[model samples]
Target: MIESAYIHIPFCSHICNYCDFAKVLYQKKWIFNYLDALKKEIQLNYQNELLKTIYIGGGTPTALDLEEFKYLLEIISTLNKQKEYEYTIECNVESLTEEKVKSMKQYGVNRISIGVETFHKHHLKIMNRHHTKEQVVEAILLLKKYGFQNINIDFIYALPNETIEEVVSDLCNFLKLDIPHISTYSLMIEPNTPFYLNHIKTIEEELDFSMYEKICRTLKKNGYEHYEISNFAQPGYESKHNLAYWNNAFYYGFGLGASGYIPEIRYTNTRNLTKYCNGEFCFNQEKIDFKTKMENEMILGLRKLEGVNLIQFKQKYGKEMDSIFPIRQLQKEGKLQVHNRYLRIPEEQLYLSNEILMQFIDT
Candidate 1:
């Protein structure tokens, strides 16, 4: 049973230089039409299963005016949610308002993930993000006031010319907010983004590695669990929505540019706004064959700190994991290990997880 769904709202008040997601400048004229199309898309695809998690991500879901935002929530209310469901909405500090927060609270939004990439002015300027540190604090306080505490803030490190001190400072500021979850990312200059268009380069590989190490160490020291590679959360605060993805579980993805996995099919919606608004949702899809399914199970399962369960793997696929891949070889190389019956990358080697994961690609 598909137990999760991700809804994308592809409109933002301002575009960040590093963003490559499918999004458009927020326009009043398109809001109604886009939301209408989104509602239709959900109605057509949703199977009315009792979802355990529903994440409403962006292009800043908070960018919508109060009426539009509430309308969007109304549409989402149609989805059947378990009694103890986790409903998350991504917000930007500049766009999150008291009215919206109250509306979200009323509509059963239990989690709020904010895009507070950095607290440094220079870094924010470089990224074309306009929220001040003051605004971020106020937004957090407001969310807390509304009895919403399952908060998460995104952090970006390893920017061009970034220093260790700056990274430390940002970490300090983030800790002060006392939020439970943080998702850290190293900046990647994807093609077509302003950073790539402006010929910007990423920080040196060694420095990037060092910064990631610092983040992991510091967060761990502060009583946060490095549960997934790039995510840290206070115990009991991990993102259930994201865990669905890492588990390779089936989920419905709705709206422009969203992707979904259902049973044996994985598909992405059309990124073109014109096409999406015209009800042309699917852009591409691929059938998951048996070999691909096993590969995906291994690749996605290994992302957790506890790794994959060998017994569960055998029971699900009817084959031993070592019989299918180079698990024994990787364990011999000290890159992978079995702890308490869970196969995982050693904590010390997690920074090289991408490289280790690549070894499973064709096996």
Candidate 2:
């Protein structure tokens, strides 16, 4: 009953300083071989289920040349797609050409998430991202010209030395676009990324918190629902594929470094390209137990603004929330509350949700 799949293309024309995803410079030889491996992996694992959503993420999936992008699409065409499926691809404005956009349309791509980290040229250079503001404008205009309206633009705030004014400026530009979806993330200098290697530090906590509050307030005022902690969407445009993950549903993850979840198992593909291409797709997997599943159910479900459904949880897991976890304690602490039958974190306390969620870890 897996209804979603995430395909990864670990090839980028230029590596951004903050990115640590499994990726390498776009090499023609590697691209062809990787496509072969990806196709084989899908053929072997896909059970012909009519997937409701398929997300093609990167290393910039649109970085491929015109012919290579077409071949990749052709490979994806073999999947059993639902009548009204959501097929999304991650793209960078510089490489997402007109031909690629048309090819995506022909292959049933209904959504395109662009990597416009920030609108400021100085911030772009600071993050080692090459696309200019004008390029992003052209890219969006082009996508709209092709009748693709379900678009999302990613933004990263809390950069080293980043100010609230800069973040406000970026949001101002984003609001003008009138796009349906937006995903914003705070800067975390994870180990192994160029930012980490160069000793980049995050912004002050107060500023970071302020930036988050600003983003939430602005997007909500502009008629976007704060569906998730980092995602805002206009009613019907929330990413179905991502919602699958937060809902604790199963999905297939294909390609090097991709992760997937089945009925009781979660697996991640190997990051080593050589091993991945040689048919060693998954390197780590864990069989999930009932206790683990329940914990995951709470942790993942609580991420949504609406939180988890009480009766649905009992029906699915055969246990009430109070019987399985300390719901009353969280409720007493004012961290979680029930609203219209849904147990959710209060809007003001969402920023501290991680601390509250940790209490249910092993209960």
lDDT of 1 at 249: 96
Clashing pairs in 1: none
Worst 10 residues of 1 by lDDT: 297-306
- In model 2, the worst 10-residue window by lDDT is 115-124
Give model 1's TM-score versus the native structure: 0.99
Error of 1 at 134 (Å): 0.3
Q: Write the per-residue lDDT of candidate 2 for residues 192-248, one digit (tens) a residue.
A: 998999898898888888999999999999999999989999999999999999999
lDDT of each model, Cα atoms only? 0.95, 0.93
Candidate 1 local Cα displacement, residue 131, angstroms: 0.4
Report the Cα lDDT for residue 274, model 1.
Answer: 91
Task: Write down the TM-score of every candidate.
Answer: 0.99, 0.99
